[model samples]
Target: MATAPGHPIDVHTWSTPNGWKIPVMLEECGLPYRVVPVNIGRNEQMAPDFLALSPNNKIPAIVDPDGPGGAPIAVFESGAILQYLGRKTGCLYPADERARVAVDEWLFWQVGGLGPMLGQAHHFRIYAEEKIPYAIARFTDEARRLYGVLDRRLADREHVAGDYSIADVAILTWAKYHEKQGVDLGPLPHVRRWLDGVLARPAVQRGLAAI
Candidate 1:
């Protein structure tokens, strides 16, 4: 379905897990959007224009020309952006309070826990200038534990939060880089299964390719 006329939403992002979420959400919502690349490696996110949109100087912020009350609005943070798009389109985010709560639980889990710990793991294990054994072990162990949690969560359900909501979308980008975090998926069969299923979605393919 072609999106409605007028300015497409502007997605200011880079090619990273956090950056991938907004474009993925926009694609899944079928919302018209255009990507404005922010190369963090070159500190482009610190540009005055980009900072005006995302005060935190983070990738994956957005400007919606058609926003609440038909006024333009800029949104920062991947999780917040996902929730906003979900609510705006009335898609993955369930209207039922209970169902929404479940989704929120997992969404926050990814944004707050899974993403951070795994990021630390990635830093220490792969990107750190001087790798500290303790830091590497600590985060890698934590990454393993988090994957175990996700594995068990998917043992019965096909997706996180009882459905393929933004929770899965949020987690998938980070989880997709399991190898970089010094974690193996062999022991986590359920997570491997869930990952395969989510990756197979056409919307997910398009979203991941948006970079």
Candidate 2:
């Protein structure tokens, strides 16, 4: 669908997992947007302009020209951005109360639990200044446990939440970095299957390319 007159969606992001979420959603929703790359490595995310959009000093912020009541809107955080796009386009986000709740549950699950744990695992396993065995083992084990939970959740369903909502987009973004996070999917057949399905989408391919 065409955006409101004179107001296009501006996506500010890097090439990280979180950064990929917005592009994926925009593609999935068939919305037109502009990409503004933020080089986190050089501290561009901390710049005054980017910081105004994402006060948390993070990648994947957005400025929607046409927001609620036709005013421009700026949103930060990958999860919130997904929810905004979902609600705006009425594509991945469910309109029904129960279905929306289910989607929110898993979306929050990733934002609060899965993403943070895996991030710690990545820090300890790869980026840390010092190699701490205790930290590495602790986070890796937690990452494994979270993967198991997702594997079981996907045993009967093709998507994380009902009908491939924003929740799947949220978690799948992070789930793609299994190796970097020190996670093993060998025994998580269900998760593997689900990941394959999501990765096969043309929109997902285009979204990943945006990063």
Candidate 3:
């Protein structure tokens, strides 16, 4: 469903990789939206009102005034939000079945593998008070392996999937944090090239600057 005129989509988010995904999408689609900061550092996501919108208590939930059948709808989860926006605007998402399948595979890969493994690496290597070498090594290694997968995937193509779909945007958010994930891009040339190109987008810059 398309967003209503004068009633921009409400993006409940913070300054995070997941948080930046929605605004980047809205910017890419030229959809009007306003950021409603949910300061995760202050535990604001646990608020009852926010919880009603996002049962998972995630930072990047959205409240669309114009949803299916012209009703309001709230969507949680970064991957689902990307898919919703993609379908809503028909911008970066492909309509063709086979192409869409390709996009979904990489999108789910980011949500299930890349994002989480990199997040774990960040937590263990940077955020955790008691840094266990085992945990740090485990996640960092996983992060490196995931980056290797992406590097290989981009060896022949420009984007993660067929085109610059939501999959690229999803993976880009996490991949940009390679340094913090204990990964050196020196070994992953393709990823560095892809990341550079994605980061050069005006919409992405604006979305990141918004938060």
Candidate 4:
């Protein structure tokens, strides 16, 4: 079955959680795709070609030629990309209506809450020109609060929802880096376990690798 020029997919990303999700999903879904690592730290993503697809100047964008009615599709926003990939190959997401919506909740939560909050903490603590104590506290506290949410939710379950799905994958990448970014994980034993479990997946390890 000859699909097209870009049959499987084309991903522009880097070696980050936000970036890692593409390769992770590709590997998990067992889809054949090309990997283009867009280095935002080096202004690679802002290049005119890359910007044409993802104007937000973010990594983790995709060009799926065999998308929606067998046409090319350009998608941005990690959460949106995740949902698309999940629907495409059917991994890390369920077919059940209720479970799928629940997975969407955690995915959106990570994209909105965990991703943004930890990003601020990293910016203030590691990248900010002036180390403002209040700003640092504000973001770091928010990061911990999000971690607390994960901890509480994971207290009695193995994954974010009822099963191991993209919901866990979407959040654990940043949660795993909490210590390196100066957020403590001492009180979140359940979260720690969940992170470890997700990282143990071969697909996850492959995802975290430099593309």
Candidate 5:
């Protein structure tokens, strides 16, 4: 089962926003993969085997048996995984340096800013044992501000980077969880339109259903 002829990707992931990115990319690339669930709630992500693939003790790592030079490759971080898949498949990720740079900008923006802000909003608003108003407002405001940036970016374009690349995949995964972050898309018509367009994609639908 480790080295099958057709199915070479073994996606070790959970059903989180970060976890869903890889599957969405894989599906978008038309790559065959098998999902190995990592139960983070039960500390499964801290296990030795899972940690070997994802040293950060995170879900959504992948083991690609047919990597560069036909060797296996294990990658962590949803952003890194998306970049690798785009490079390997020659899809989603642009070959042109300028276009690739554009994609990287939005992809990194989601990773460094959007995801963390939204995650903090979710924690303070939902998971935290003590609901601190200061923390809640801080994160919620940040999330709203970030959403405004994204909304403006998409005002004239269908996608973040002017084309539907991994940038859209990365951002939409977190954006789709707006309710959990206490986000309101009603005022951001451009973001709402872009989100609706991304959600309507057949690949996105399949990726969201992967888990």
Candidate 6:
């Protein structure tokens, strides 16, 4: 469905995993919203208009015209955006308190851990064009170690926690890149299974699309 004029939402994003988390959930919940791609590679985030919405000049910010008080709510952080949409749509984030926290824990784990580690690794290993051995080892090892942490946590669960909540949605697309880096999945049987579960979600597929 198309978002009506003065649509409830306007999402600024790139086609990144961090970027896709919100859209995937929005699409999954069938929410009507608009997408405004932020070309981070071209320094578009530095523009005055984008910076006004996201002072940090980041992608994945959102403006909700029909927010809690019917005022446009500008949200910057990806996790914050996910939570905002969850409360608005009443899905993705679990309703039960304990389950919700568990999901949030994993979300934080990725946002604070896996995402940064892998991003650094990608910077030095792929984008830099300079070998930068120390940086590569530092990032790649951290990414591997962090993946181990997740692999261990997933040993007994199908998803990151009890149900398929924002936790899974937050981290899935990013983790999908591990295989391309020669990161071993053999030791992470549980993580692999968990990933399979996440991959099966229709929302995940829709979210990863180049919007």
Q: What are the TM-scores, per candidate, against the unseen true structure?
A: 0.96, 0.96, 0.97, 0.93, 0.96, 0.92
The lDDT, on a scale of 0 to 1, for candidate 4 is 0.83
Tens-digit per-residue lDDT, 47-146, candidate 2: 9988888889988999998899998999999998999889888989999999999999999999999989998999999999999999999999999999
Candidate 3 lDDT by residue in tens digits, 130-175: 9899999999999999999999999999998988989988988888
Q: C-alpha displacement of 111 in model 2, angstroms?
A: 0.4
For model 5 the local lDDT of residue 127 reads 96
Worst 10 residues of 2 by lDDT: 1-10
Q: Is candidate 4 or candidate 5 better by lDDT?
A: 5
Q: Candidate 4, residue 207: CA error in Å?
A: 1.1
Model 3: lDDT to the true structure:
0.91
The most accurate candidate by lDDT is 3
Model 4 agreement with the true structure over 25-73: per-residue lDDT tens digits = 7777777788877877798988999989998888889999889899899
The residue-by-residue lDDT of candidate 6 on 1-211, one tens digit each, is 2343446478899987788877887777777778888988898989999999999887889988888877668999888888888887788788889988898899888888888778787778888978888888888888889889888888887778777788888888788888644478888888888887788777677667737
TM-score of 6: 0.92
C-alpha lDDT score of every prediction, in listed order? 0.90, 0.89, 0.91, 0.83, 0.90, 0.81
The runs of at least 3 residues in candidate 4 whose Cα sits more than 4 Å from the true structure, single-residue gaps closed, are 1-6
Worst 10 residues of 1 by lDDT: 1-10
